[model samples]
Target: MSEISNNDDIRTILLPSAPFGIPEVTANDAEGTWGLRRLGVPHPDVYAMADIVSCTVRELECEGTAGPAVGEARGMELLGEVLKNPGKVARANKYKGGAYCGGVYLEVTLRDPTADKLIIPVWGRELKRGSMAYRQVIESAETVKAAFDEMIEGGSRG
Candidate 1:
């Protein structure tokens, strides 16, 4: 794990690697950008990505939207798809937007058209408290990793 600080307002965490050669996850408090990246690479190679604005989580939860739950489910589904067949996902590129998932948006895009590299970008509003968003992002990233681990160990889809 690593901590990156650009200024007083911005704080970023480089999370541990996910199971099965998955890319590294990152969470930035200030910009509300968080997701997976293949580090030690030259270009911008984000395998999976997500962002959230301040107070978005609280609002969704308060409004009885179950935003976090929905987000996790969708994230897991996308991750499974990516793991199973990245090339198919890259060619289809159908995962995007989250209006149906109660504001927890997930977008899958081909970062490099020449290569089969894809990036999954999820977006929600944000959390209110300091570091809440950061923590939540970490939680989400960890959840993905754990699920992936479970799938690997148990031979089941997580």
Candidate 2:
């Protein structure tokens, strides 16, 4: 894992690159979130892991301190949730957003154990619309799911 320190002193953890050309996974200590994307890709589609606790708190109109420990706890909770249904949980919790800078076409699919898979439609003015983009999305999702599986099995967070 590689670490990057921002001006705010938040350390961004770039997890090991996914196998088979999938984008790398990034974990943020401040926001308690993770995402899959190619570095330096401008306005790329957002393929992010969701933290239900944080989402729920936001939805119910709440806030909290942006501390490292808080983020660590949230990350642990997210891991636990993913452990429930590694395959389906990651797909369900994955957040997809458009490539546009200002106007994002976001699509979030809820968790459904019976569903085969969640399809995230890419949208953005600058998005490269082709087989490559489509394949990247699919591969990134699968990589994330696999990462969750490995993390749960190994009892580690990455």
Give the TM-scores of the predictions, in the order they appear: 0.23, 0.24
Candidate of highest TM-score: 2
RMSD of 1: 18.3
Candidate 1 Cα lDDT to native: 0.37
Q: Write the per-residue lDDT of candidate 1 for residues 1-158, one digit (tens) a residue.
A: 33434446433343333332324444434443444565455333322222111111111222323233322346679788778877655434322232222122222333345653233322244333235554665456454434333323332221
Clashes of each: 5, 0
Candidate 2 residue pairs that clash = none
Candidate 1 weakest lDDT stretch, 10 residues: 50-59
lDDT digits (tens) for residues 1-158 of candidate 2: 23433436233333333233223444444554445455455433332343211111001101221223222346778677667756544333331222212111212332344533322222222222245654454354444444444333333343
Weakest 10 consecutive residues of candidate 2 by summed lDDT: 53-62
Model 2 lDDT, residue 140, Cα: 43
RMSD (Cα, Å) of model 2: 21.2
Candidate 1: residue 34 Cα off by (Å): 1.8
Instruction: Give all candidates' CA lDDT scores.
Output: 0.37, 0.35
